[model samples]
Target: MAKEATLQVRMDADLKEKAEALYRDMGTSFAEAVRIFAKQSVQENGMPFAMTANRKNTYGRLSGYANTKLAAEEDGAYEREMVGKHEKTD
Candidate 1:
């Protein structure tokens, strides 16, 4: 058996309740969810799921603006234009 590492996280009360309810519905515990996430993170180099529940709050007005089709198109165009724009010639 592998040794277990403990992690302490602080989360919003409402979000915690929602996560706990969802986990219970799936017949799993919050700790199980954390373990699964950790396992995935270790296997893959990135997160297995979108954990940014506070995206809208964190992004503020930009969140709503970015969700629109027009904004998405514009964002893609901007990103493509910016990519490889500053390559070093060493």
Candidate 2:
């Protein structure tokens, strides 16, 4: 058997409590959930899920435009605009 190591993490008290309750309802502990996440991350060679910036917070009022279509479409448009600006300057 492999030696077990302790992993400590800090988070808001409310967030921790909520996460614990969520995992408990799923018939698992938060610690076990974290372990599963770690194992999956190792297997995937990176994060198990995509990491993306919160567009609503990053762009502020631009979230209003997101109502026109999917939020992904807005994010794509923003990325294209940024690339176009860089191309024009180069």
Candidate 3:
């Protein structure tokens, strides 16, 4: 028999929710999910998964919200600078 190892991972709420939702859809629990991963890891060099995907120009998506937010932040910074310049120097 092979020695057993324990692994711990920290994930964000949204990610955890996505994973749990996928597992539930597949009729699985979190512990069973971990066991599945361990089996895969032991079989291959690592678990198979897509790490990230480029989502640029995706319609009605979170990326659009992020872009809009960044532009708003830059506009706010410019307004702050203008206000500081117009302040009374007395």
Candidate 4:
């Protein structure tokens, strides 16, 4: 038999409730979902999904505009143009 471990995670109350509800609707609990994610990650030898930084409330009026690219092939020219485009902060 495999030993079990516990992992305590802190997150927004509302977010946690919503996620747990969604998991329940899918016939699982949030903890189970996390465990599945962990197992998949191990099988894949890395993260099973792509992770991106949240852009909201970043630093500019448009929030993360300076870090965005117009296209994957633009070579970062889009980021330069996005900066200072919206001067009003917040």
Off by over 4 Å in 2: 1-3, 54-90
Best by lDDT: 2
Give TM per candidate.
0.50, 0.56, 0.40, 0.54
For model 1 the TM-score comes to 0.50
Which residue pairs in candidate 3 collide? none
Please name the candidate that would achieve the greatest TM-score relative to the true structure: 2
lDDT against the true structure, per candidate, is: 0.72, 0.79, 0.69, 0.73
Per-residue lDDT tens digits for candidate 3, residues 1-90, read 554776676757897888889999999977678887777878887645433335543333444435566677787797788788889553
Candidate 3 stretches greater than 4 Å from native: 1-7, 45-90
lDDT of 1 at 73: 73
| Cα lDDT for residue 66, candidate 4 | 44
lDDT of 4 at 43: 98
lDDT of 4 at 48: 79
Worst 10 residues of 4 by lDDT: 56-65
| Model 4 C-alpha lDDT per residue in residues 1-90, reported as the tens digit of each score | 364788998767998999999999999999989999999999999877554454443333334334345445577666755765555443
Residue-by-residue lDDT tens digits, candidate 2, 1-90: 574799988767998999999999999999989999999999999877664455545344444444555555677787799999999999
